[model samples]
Target: MLKGRIIKALSGFYYVEHEGKLYETRARGKFRKTHETPLVGDIVSFQIENETGGYINEIHARKNSLMRPPVANIDQLLVTMSMKSPEFNYYLLDRFLAYGEAHDMEPVIVVTKTDLGNDVGKLEEIKNVYEGVYPIHFTDRNNINENLNDIFKDKLNVLSGQSGVGKSTLLNTLVPGLELHTAEISNALNRGKHTTRHVELVEVGGGFIADTPGFSTIEFSEIDKYNIKYCFPDFNAYSDDCKFRECSHINEPKCGVKSAVESGQLAKSRYDSYLAIHQEIDNRKERY
Candidate 1:
């Protein structure tokens, strides 16, 4: 048996790469009975049938996985956001950040479209909110940030964002000859079409990155309201001081998180996002 990592999954076939060679493989029938579906980033052991074809006999353990993109063992999530066209939405960005944090994936903030307009106030606001909390990179179509060049080495990264945020354009810039399809934002709807059809790990800067389809909504179906607070890293500093050990940071007196927000130590936008997501999870539970 040979061990390999799955690079792509299309038309019920998995393209696994082993020792610089690609193999077309199918999962064993036991996986169907066990309800184990292999993902794109799964490390699998397969038995070779011929020179290029095989059957995946076993799947190795995974450190992490994402349901939306259906990728496993991701190290970083390069969350892309725009400054003007789609208009930077803090709520949306926070949602993505929380989603990544919940899945144990490191979140890196990438802001694009600096050349579109010079909105110093908007830029400053972004920096004020997330500068120290997370790594943020600014770039435009003509120039990619220099800091971004160093993060991909030896780490599996995923580029993801809302529609029309220049994710494909950014990928094209990062990996030359990729020429991924990019569409102009619609004037009436103010959203770009989903140009990326499938998930394929493309190597870049000595690592692999999957350019995934842009999505507008994210759900917290897997997480509960009580556990959602841990997803917000910014809340950690003040959460310890809350009066109750189980304080949810809402309607609890002497809550450290609330105090930090009131004292300007924590951005209110982040706190508001926490409330919004907490409410979302609560509402989801109510319906069920």
Candidate 2:
């Protein structure tokens, strides 16, 4: 059996790349019983059959996975958001951040399409909230290409955002002929038409990038209310200062996170998003 990494899965075949060559392959039958379908970005073992495809024999462990895009073992997520179309949304941004933090993937805040939305001040407003908590790259049509390589350098990064946030446009800019289809935000839908339908890794800038369908919403299925606080990095430094060891930061008196929010030490929007998500998780717990 030869070892390879699955770069794409189409129809019923898995496309595994090994030694610079792609081997069209299929997962072993046993996977069906286990309900384990081979996922893109999975390192798999298979047997090559001359010219015909191959059969994947085993799948290796993954570092992380996202249910929304259904990709695995990614190093970081380029969390792209638009400053104009669809507008800036802290709740959505915080949700992506929480998901990234929960799965141990580094989150890079990338604001694209600053020029399209006609809102000049929106960019600064976005930076004021996220820059303090994460590394942010603010780009427009003018210079996104120049910075693409640096953001994608040496990491298996996923190009992700909500539909029509310029995820494909960004990829096309990085690779001249990539030619990923792009569309304007539908006036009816108020969001970009979904241009990317599947997950496939494209080799670019000394690294691999998986352009996934943009996600407008994400659920905290893997995390519960009690532990969700830790996903917010801003909350970590102050959680230790709370009066009680188990303080949830919402209602607890002398809670460090809340106090920081009240005093402007932390972005009020960030705290509000956290509390909103916290309540969502709380609501989820009571449902069962």
Candidate 3:
């Protein structure tokens, strides 16, 4: 048996890369009986039937998985946003960050379209707020190759951002010869159409990058509230100091998180996101 990683999955076939060679393979029958569908990024053991094709015998364990893109064992999520054009939505950015945090994946913020006049001072403000917690990269074509090459070196990363934020353009820039489609933002709607229809794990620059469809909505139902605070790296120090033993950091008078917010130690925006997600979890409880 040879070991390899599933680079792509389509139409009941998995394209695996083993020893620098790609092989078309199918999963074992046991996976079908167990209802276990192998996903992109899965490492598996397989037997070569022909020089070009094989049969996947066993699927190894996964480190993490996301339903939207359906990829597993993601090392980092490169969350992209624009400075102008469609504009940056802090709420949406926070949601993506929360999703990464919940899955134990590193979140890196990549701000695109820096050439578009950097209006409204939003880019600077975002960098100031998030730089302390996560790495941030700024890019336009002039410096995109340097920025992305430095960031994605020897790591498995995923590119996720608002539709018009130049994700596909960046991908094309990073990996030349890629034919990923790029679209213009609608003048009337101020949004770009979804161009990437499927999830694909592409080998690039001696590492792997998954190009996923732009997401309009992200759900956190798979995450539990008890562990949510851990996702916000900035909240770590204060969260441990909460007066109550079981402080949820909401409606608790002596909550350390709240105190930090009042004292301007923690960004009000981040705290607001926490409260918003907490409320959603609370509503879910009521429904249950």
- Specify the highest-TM-score model's number: 1
Tell how far residue 263 is off in model 2, in angstroms. Answer: 2.0
Q: In candidate 1, what residue range of length 10 has the lowest lDDT sum? A: 187-196
Q: Write the per-residue lDDT of candidate 3 for residues 1-288, one digit (tens) a residue.
A: 999899888777889888898899998888989888888888899999997678999989988976656788888888888877777778777878988888777888888888888465776778778987988888885677365676666667877776778877888888777756686433124233232234568777667888653444567788777777777789887988898877888888888899999998888999899878877877887888
lDDT per model vs. reference: 0.86, 0.78, 0.78
**Model 3 error, position 235 (Å):** 0.3
Q: Which residues of candidate 3, in runs, are more than 4 Å off?
A: 119-121, 184-199
- Pull out the clashing pairs in model 1: none
Q: What is the TM-score of each candidate against the true structure?
A: 0.91, 0.87, 0.89
User: Which candidate, 2 or 3, would have the higher lDDT against the true structure?
Assistant: 2
Write candidate 2's Cα lDDT for 133-183 as tens digits. 888987776677466577667678876667767777787777677676676
| Pairs that clash in candidate 3 | none
Better of 1 and 2 by TM-score: 1
| Each model's total of backbone clashes | 0, 0, 0
Indicate the worst ten consecutive residues by lDDT in candidate 3: 187-196
Better of 1 and 3 by TM-score: 1
Root mean square deviation (Cα) for candidate 3: 3.4
